[model samples]
Target: MEAVAKLNNYPTSPRKMRLLADMIRGMEVEKALAQLEHNPKHPAVPLRKLVVSAISNWKQKNEGGDESTLIVKTIFVDGARTIKRMRPAPQGRGYRVRKRSNHVTVIVDTK
Candidate 1:
């Protein structure tokens, strides 16, 4: 059985989000949750919520199924549209600043 959850346009770079994603990529549901809970990274918060939502989705899809055996089957982050802004520079020129965003997907399945 599999369940999926997605977070879109999260205001964080894919590189940073991937760090957390990599940490819990193949971990068990319980262990992953614990790891997220203890992690200080900002991305960990949404990732943890996504995992919980995925687990809830699994439970809904398979009534009476146990969640203890669930593992994060796949989790990936992709780049989203970047917002560009101008920052004042010393030479009367505006430096382009890119505010990055990302989309994250999590797939959970029974181990």
Candidate 2:
């Protein structure tokens, strides 16, 4: 059995989030949480929250499920949108700025 959780509109770029997600893929739930907790990257906070949400989903779906048996089967991050803005530059020129966002999904399943 598997359970999935998603974090939408996260204020980080997809490329950055994917790097953190890759580290925890196929890892046990507990270990993944620990790794995320200690990670120095700012993206770790959202990833940690996402993992916890996945665990909660697993528990809710399986009333008698043992958490110790669960593992992070897969994790993915995808680009959502880039909010475009204009910033004033030197010489009366305007520069385009893109603020990126991402969507993250994590799946957990029992061993």
Candidate 3:
């Protein structure tokens, strides 16, 4: 059985989140956590939390099951709502500033 967790509207670009997702995809739960813990990327903090949440969810579904064999089965990021703002330009015109956001999903299961 797979356990799932998600982070929604995480206030970062999907590409940025995907980089970390790629780094941890198909990795064991313990190794992923270790990698995320030392990662300097801003998204790593929330990503780490998301993985922990998945572990907790797995624990809930399979009571007393050992998590040592668990791996990150699948993880992905999708673009979310973008916040657009206007920035003043040199020619007295407004430039559209897009603040990208993303939703991340993580699935964990036994190897």
Candidate 4:
């Protein structure tokens, strides 16, 4: 059995989020949370919360299971809609600015 959680439209680039996700992939839940808690990364904060949420989901699904055995089974980040804006450039020209966002999914299962 497994549990899944998702974070949608997170206001960060998929590339940035994937960096943190890769570090925690296949790691034990408790260790991952501890690593995320102390890591000095912007996206780590939200990713930490997402893991906690997945743990909660696992509890709800399995009434009597050891959480220590849980692991980050699968995780992925996908690019979301980009917010486009115009920036003023020299010589009365305009530059395009894209604010990227991403959707993250985490699936946890017993090791």
lDDT of 3: 0.97
Q: Write the per-residue lDDT of candidate 3 for residues 7-109, one digit (tens) a residue.
A: 9999999999999999999999999999999999999999999999999999999998999999999999999999999999997899999999999999999
Q: Tens digit of lDDT per residue, candidate 1, span 1-111?
A: 899999999999999999999999999999999999999999899999999999999999999998889999999999999999999999799999999999999999998
lDDT of 1 at 105: 96
Give the residue spans of candidate 1 off by over 4 A: none
What is the TM-score (0 to 1) of candidate 4?
A: 0.98
Give TM per candidate.
0.98, 0.96, 0.98, 0.98
Colliding residue pairs in candidate 3: none
Off by over 4 Å in 4: none
Candidate 1 clashes between residue pairs 3 or more apart in a chain or in different chains: none
RMSD values, in order shown: 0.5, 0.8, 0.5, 0.6
lDDT of 4 by residue, 10-89 (tens): 99999999999999999999999999999998999999999999999999999999998999999999999999999999
Q: Which candidate is the best by lDDT?
A: 3
- Return the candidate ranking by lDDT, descending: 3, 4, 1, 2
